[model samples]
Target: MESNEPLYVIPERYRKIENLHIVFWLLKDLCWVMLWRPLGLVMIVPTIGAAALITWQTRHIKSELLHNIAVFFWIIANAYWMITEFFTTDDSLRYYAVIPFSIGIVAIAYYYIGLRFAIKK
Candidate 1:
């Protein structure tokens, strides 16, 4: 048997980090919807669909800078939501929700910074 193959291939410089960042943001957004929706898990289907599209489109990209910027905005939005939730005095459930909401904001900021570094290279 004989086989023929291309002698060389160049691996993409930004593939791994970009993909991971996209996945993290998508998951966090899904978590947000799940946490806020009245139906809980039922809201995850639309989140999953959006994630699939984002993953598919970003899988081959070599630039993550824009994605990082997007993540930063997402964190800011989440932080605002959490702060509002924390201030609500009517329900204990709203008070308890602030914990996870704040945690999600922190996670978004962390990943956004990481992705920024990844794009800098």
Candidate 2:
């Protein structure tokens, strides 16, 4: 049995960008893990750019928009945490990552607690 709900398919171009986004995200994390500071710093631009682009592209879809926005924040938090580690051995500054992390969480929470209900109604 199939319910009557339209399927959501990302445009091929969008999907391509999304795939590339994954590559950039992974490369950024890899560079961070390997302690390649320069490359990791460079990777942030493309990684965050792709995330922002995805969020913009999905703005019309509330769920996708919220999730993509969360992804954007998640990358920011990750990059910031990476930078903190790269710059200092101490974890003192790592707490700053909480800001972006919380933003990401709020975005998801809003989607689940607010937008999800609004959409169903």
Candidate 3:
């Protein structure tokens, strides 16, 4: 990663919007890991919304498409987990959800690393 580069280059006009996308990205993770346990189902609303905004902002960057896809999948997994919490009385099921959930985080990490290299180009 470029030490000076905090973000991938975007048109000056879209810089703020792009930054919002990053905030939403982090917020989605925050909402899931922390907020969902306390606030319950409402967390998915912003989680999906952030993922949508992220996809929209990064759509033109071909290198990010896969990363975005991984993110969406991860978000879906989280949504599934949240929904299960409501409908299932089984506590052990969440243990199983950890597999996909962990994969999503790994995918997001790959996206970040890929973005760093993509910007280097």
Candidate 3 lDDT over 1-121, as tens digits, reads 4487576666764566556656654665565566455444565666677666766777887556557766767777767776667678898876776776677667776667866678779
For all predicted structures, in order, the TM-scores are: 0.30, 0.92, 0.50
Which one wins by lDDT: 1 or 3? Answer: 3
lDDT of 3: 0.66
How much lDDT does candidate 1 score? Answer: 0.48
| Lowest-sum lDDT 10-residue window in model 3 | 35-44
Q: State which candidate has the highest lDDT.
A: 2
Better of 1 and 2 by lDDT: 2
Q: So what's the TM-score on candidate 2?
A: 0.92
- Candidate 1 Cα RMSD (Å): 11.7
lDDT of 2 by residue, 2-118 (tens): 979988788999999999999999999999999899999999999999999999999998889999999999999999999999898788899999999999999999999998788
Q: Write down the lDDT that model 2 would get.
A: 0.95
Task: List model 1 lDDT by residue over 1-121, tens digit each.
Answer: 5669655333463355446545655665565555554332333344344434444555454333244434444444453453344445455544454554555455556556766677789
RMSD of 2: 1.7
Q: Report the error of model 2 at residue 27, Å.
A: 0.4
Candidate with the greatest TM-score versus the true structure: 2
How many clashing residue pairs, candidate 2? 0
